[model samples]
Target: MDLLTLLDPLMTSPLLYPLLAGLGSLDGVLPMIPSEAAILTAGVFAHTGAPSLLLVVVATALGVFIGDHLAYGLSRSVLGPRLINRSKYARRAVAVAGRQLDRRAGLLIVTSRFLPGGRVTMNAACGTARVPLSRFSPASAIAALAWAAYMAGLGYLGGAAFVENPLLGLAVGLALSFACGGIVELVRRWTARRAPRAAGAADPGRGRSPAAASRGQVGSRRVRRALVSATAAVAVLAAPAAAAATPKEADRVGMRSRLDDVVATGAVGALAEVRDEHGAWRATSGVAELGRTRAVPAGGRFRVGSITKTFVATVVLQLVAEGRLGLDDPVETWLPGVVPNGRRITVRHLLDHTSGLYDVVETLPMPPGPEFLDNRWRTWTATELVARALANPPTFEPPGSAYAYSNTGYLLLGQIIEKVTGRSYGDEIERRIIRPLGLTGTSLPGTWPRISGPHPHGYLPTLRDGETHLIDYTEMNPSMMGAAGEMISTTRDLNRFFAALLGGRLLPGHLLDEMRTPGVRGASYGLGLDWWDTSCGIRVYGNDGDALAYRSWSYSTEDLRRQVTVAVTPDFRGDPDHVVDAFLDQAFCG
Candidate 1:
């Protein structure tokens, strides 16, 4: 018989809740009672309206809470002292746990519940450390609730999505749970491996006099600083070896190695492309999906998020060049009473993000959790989106007085483009930029939910019971983002578009200069494009884009000779940005 057939009677029985509770409590002490499996099975059955979902959640949480406290009390009274006295390793582990508890006891306690064997270890550590009941109780309660909700929610989602085959739903839910555990374990192991290398990099003068050690450390820092400065200068100024000399194979290796590091930091997949006077090079790392061995597509299209602002801004500039729109014209002239401070806000104000408009995206249900799944397919009209923003007062009085990044401002810019050209915002972008540049991989998806081409699936990492639940968020209605961020494009298309824009193929020299000029003092953003001053003291212009689970960056040198575009589906557990920065340093600073 199949596993489900054998467990069917127990799952549908009145004894189910008490059985779940008993198993949950026993698992805390024994560490192998399969409490999670029991909970998941009950949850799957609960979806068919047998044992109540609410009862299942409550029973599981109650059992876990009781078990955790029982473990804590036993360790405090008996097991903890015996272990510490018998093993040096146990003592050292407890000492480390003590230090962590002193800093963030609640967070450590809560997150531990999700890790395999973490619950027992932390309970023993906490008890030995003499953590007070008052502090521990609240954190434990929250952990129990979060754990029950997440596990039950997972089964419910699976059941809902695959109603025709309930057994398949149960299997899928269990698989996802195991995957989350595996990812957490892998991240822990990876971190442990790095610790030794970091320790080795520290001072080697532990046996020397304090004065001698201090002097040696100072000298070492100075030498490193000097080397960094020199390397930065060479990396920034040197042309691609293909253009000036022999191909730099070492540089290509360095880029690939850095991309691998990015994946090791918990990104599911990453794709990057770099171009220069010599030629173009591409690199990818990690799997496109969680359980599959499929590689990320070489020419994958992804939602560009706020990077769409650059394209929209370019279209607005083209209108300016054609005498169809003016930079200083009041927004009131076009929209008329749509914005509270319409007369005060100008086209320049909108492009530069100095209009002080409140961001509408903040008010939407775009959180990286269950709420996103509930509303992912909901389409929104631009009028309704703008009205939501208009309902709130302007962020600041007298536009252009300060800078605030507002998607609302861009939505208004899109409306202005429509007013002037008598066309939709996406239509204008297509006619003005996409067609002219022949960027076949780029498009404004409008309300369409699918990517419509080869693309890496993006996942929203939700921390449940301290485990990372990667929800596939690859498809969603883009109309909510409107002209503020709805465009999709591949890294190759992004690179070509930026190169053409910066190379003066699209905009006139004078207009392009205006687009690159920052409106507010000490701000990084200009009219449409933003500039990044790398650690090597070289400025590269581009924009970064972020949606629910996808993020991308496109950057290039002033002359368009060197350019790089990157896209990543972040796992959100590790610091992907640090590795990305390192990759940029290698690409631009050599």
Candidate 2:
């Protein structure tokens, strides 16, 4: 018998799954591990009925998830980050992965599992970038499933074709995988060749933000020289210099110069505006799109993700101030039987995510591949989402005993708003905040998927059938987020709203005081607003929002004298947090 036939007993062994899981997890930290080959070999045995296809898929999927987390944990730890930052090659790989993730996190995660060394690099990059576990976990799971499916499918087909020769089946399966890899490389090359011409033809009106462009051009020569010199050393000094500098001397650092670094970190497009006593300083970087070289508009509108929570919370607080709803009142008083422990769950619990409700998004079966594209546009109602959350039991016991973020709580809050006000949350927000503040750039799109004004295309990257594809997710129904996170606003509007609210224009003093009271982490969450203490010991209050392809951040100093609002259209290309955090620190601490 051939070598493949000889290994049949081991492949069918019950220990196979655990072995794969162990190898897969180890492969995450060490890309050279032959986890893929072992998996493929297992597939060969499955073809001969020595191991079941289902078992093989399950084993590998778990293995991939476990492995990715292990790598991510390593990167997140102090020693790992230090080692990675110290290595030039690791940093470069991380930069590439960050950029890839900016475009298509799911696609890259799934496809990387097939390419030798791809998984290790991706996990390291994600860990280095500090991409939140909430985002990484689901994407990793989807990728694991895809990898299992693809490998098993190929093995099954080969087995069916060569029933008498498992050896030939294994060879056929391995060859097909290699063929897919070749196609991916070819497609990548073609795209690169077309990029320059496409960029050159882009409209000047759509060019990079002037300040960002100026900053980029000014330091281009110096940055290039530094990058070249970095080749000789494991760590680059220039990057840490700016980050390590004292806060008092921030002005000397130059805001424009910093924005250039931010753009270089992998943001497709970024715009930052700081309004202070001196006046206003605005900067932009990268391009509006990958192929187009246009700058982001001065005040372009974009999805404000969870930042919408602040607005929703503001309205809720307004109701509380007006004595329409009590903070301690049970949610059942407003929406009867919607929540499992409605009586024990208070309105404050909803706002702070201490309601113990399970996150609805976590309950659904989020499939990878083209399957997600089908449901991308599907409209979901608030009632439906609450039902989804209710389908799963509460994640914690004794409501409000612990802190956990639950979008379901926000949706429930939205329902309560409707019950108390007898109007949609959008209408209430428009009359109370948007119209009052004259935030013309902001709107509640409701079920409308299209962004109405001048805006950058929100790009999502994916790998389907072994070829990378960039998807324009610029438009999609926000009903899925509901009151929790479906609002849209520009950086300017965000700045205005936060400034006005913090300046004590939005709510009564008593309600505002209550809103700012920390319910979790001693300071992170208030009634609806959240605060973060900068590295330099200054506290900034605001909310951050994120969608599949767009992210919005708005924050201001405690005094509201200094404020910065940023909008970023993720290109799936790089880690932009370093730039963002630096800008915030300079804006506040400085």
Candidate 3:
């Protein structure tokens, strides 16, 4: 059943508000109950014409407020002093919390509500420090209400964007909440590390005369009030300044230089496009063909190898959204007896590459020599591909135990799509994604042997008789890479497709969130997507594609505000990765 159908009863029930309140109260002590997710989901469902959004917010805030007070009371009456005296870590933590509270109690309490595990720490520390109940009560109330509004408001944004699917909206809201929490934590760490040391700032009870202690107490209250006002003023002024910032002309020049560096790494041709609030920037370097003076075309198509996995995954998710199939359904449920262990492997295992299936491409002959010329025109059926993989033992005994990239796994996915919808996977991609997004320059060529458009020639370097030869490897049948890496697309079309996909235009927000979730241990791959944490600490999502001589990389920020796509045709052996990495750093962080 669809998520909406499952959530309908909860949305209509009178107990939802009370349930949210109870969860929120429990979360104050446990910090693991996921009250935020519940609140965000309610907010999302409220936008779909169920219970009132304001009532939901009120219920959540009321619960959180009650919970904070309960924690404070318990700590003051029983747990606080005993723990502080017995544990070194507890003492240090409470001491630090006390100092911050002394300076900016109001801000600290409010901000801690949104931070996981922070609310408990701050409240316990405040109780141990014996802060006035009058001061703590007002801050706790404001923090509870503010946090409720912020979380629900994010859900409201997602709901507004995808009114047809409130569950999707909830996913979007959750993703946004995580991103915000991460940013806040990073800032907190940075400030903590850089905070200046003040002279005579030790605790008054530790190293101060009675006269000095009395004076310090009076000054602390004045400083706290001043800081609270200053914080509010700074927040108001900073918003406009941040919004005014944009990419400078120097940044474009730097990016162009980085593109040249890509060609310098022995690529015959390279092209890149970067999109942001300022606009799109296009750059190119090297030649269109061997021994030619013409530069690579600004708009050119290339065979985007495994990047096709994203397109295939998106289609599978769309089908799941339509209630056509379940992600956890066994492969054998759809295509009986095709895989030796089909019953044990799930659709999610295939999409996330944890199916333990052998990668048939490993068995294929793909030498970088003259022998490749003979097999370039050969085509293999999907059954033949799966059979080749099954001939080998499984990479691991149980499915979903480990991640092993298998093109053969996606090949099976293509077959499953065909069985479920009674149409080719390419047709579904065309109907659901390509046509809807107007991707004029993208196509799934079955056995087509040539790139049909304005494109640079691709080459592979081979050593024969102690000398290198640049083989013109542009034209080749891609059927061998069918369902996994056979699609052709331009950088512009790719950027638009990914932007739309990440911007919640293509699939339900929840499905996209699942696509972004890492499936196996110690792996960065999320379903079909690949994410990289850049040198500047910004996370971007996209996939890299590679064919015989063509290579491409596409990535975008979580908000879809910054995007980049780069592709290159090789001429010699060199590290093209250096170019891709440098270009991305310059584009997003310059």
Candidate 4:
């Protein structure tokens, strides 16, 4: 099971409410406690019916109220005087309460619950002063309720937008909470700066006569009140819309909205496929190509970029299983002298992107622009490409060092396969995987430029003569990418391939384990496959692909029961990850 799936039971446990309440109670005394995260997390769980929303709010309020009284109780205790006398902070707290808490205590208490450290200081100060229980208790109760409502309400809002991923919801809640605190701080500073000026002007003969000064002060106060009232009114009116977007409504609107959002941001076209036990849902938004009205093809093929790595890695692992290649064997054992540190780099290093080889494409003066356009038709040999990499210093100590993504490493791996089998990498892949799996929609186009059958036209944005131009980059030689990336496949073909691979149709169990084991720090890479911790808490394993004009991804749960695939042609302004996250959250989290 993925992390979120394992965490769901814990989040929904009946014991969670009391725990959250306990934390809330402590928050009044222990300002550092992350009560907001706990409350918001519980509130997020409420969206999934893990717990009732009313129960969560009430529990949170009860905890905070108990904590408030506990601090007050401590203040009235025999040791209260000694404690206040010994601690400078406590003495200062009392001074602050004496000056301001007498008048604006209610507002300060309510807002302080949202501010870090403010709750502990205020509650402690109020207790140290021995303020009447009658005066403090009722205000504390109301303040607790308001804080609970705001925290829970914000959590619910974020949960609506990010239902599958409680962590993301928590982060969003914290950001919103912090933003509220920041706005309050800014307003306080602004008011403080205005106070001295207003006071100086109010003095007789300082700027104007007493009558005129009084009128000016009144006008200034009126303007400040209007500003504060307007801000409050806008927030009150906007609250309902933000809180009312239910999960079902979010699901209904999210996918299309994400697609439209990406398109509007600059994508020429976007398409996605989500598959689960229920069935598959396909969606498309934006045009197939610029200046065309055709919708993106429903089952269109696009270059699956580095996604080809998975297929390549699978075949290599198959060879390892067949006793034809050794994972620990040095690259020098196959294509001797090709890489600078081939003797130190193992086959495993190549597969997991730990070879530390510098990416050959980075050496070029420009990529995917006018400079690349000049050489777009040039074919690149794998040996020639590796030589270009060798010409540069190794990116790091190679052969099992730091993780660095290098197309050069995969190209060398492809060459090694050719050396071992006396056949091109594409031949071995087709004979072993694609043909046997009946994936007719997939192909290694090599030097062939035209996309056959139904395919969306890929686009690349360029600047020429101070104006942006969308170029049709649908046709290009794949020889430059070679075995590393030059493959074409549709969403249907990708889904089939990943599902089969994850379902154990492609490799034995041990090899599959190896493929899923992340070997490098800070990257969830395992062989050609990688893992994504989605916004909805589930972990999905897949590879993402990026070409000059097209981008694609194929991901599946560990059990192969759920999957998502997407293809997009660049519109130049948005990242496809947002749409992918929303779509996968709905598909897998639900």
List the candidates' TM-scores in order: 0.58, 0.58, 0.58, 0.57
Error of 2 at 279 (Å): 1.4
Model 1, CA-based lDDT = 0.68
Against the true structure, candidate 3 reaches a TM-score of 0.58
TM-score of structure candidate 4 = 0.57
535-567, model 1: which lDDT tens digit per residue? Answer: 888899988777646778899989777899888
Shift of residue 11 alpha carbon in model 1, Å: 69
Q: Per-residue alpha-carbon lDDT of model 4 for 263-324, expressed as tens digits?
A: 65446677777777656666677766566566676666677878888989998999898999
For each candidate in the order shown, give its overall lDDT on alpha carbons.
0.68, 0.67, 0.70, 0.67
Q: Is candidate 1 or candidate 2 better by lDDT?
A: 1
Comparing 3 with 4 on TM-score, the higher-scoring candidate is 3
Least accurate 10 contiguous residues by lDDT in model 4: 207-216
The segments of candidate 4 whose C-alpha lies over 4 angstroms from its true place after superposition are 1-253
**Model 2 misplaced stretches (Cα beyond 4 Å):** 1-253, 364-368, 521-523
Extract clashing residue pairs from model 1: none
Per-residue lDDT, model 3, residue 312, is 94
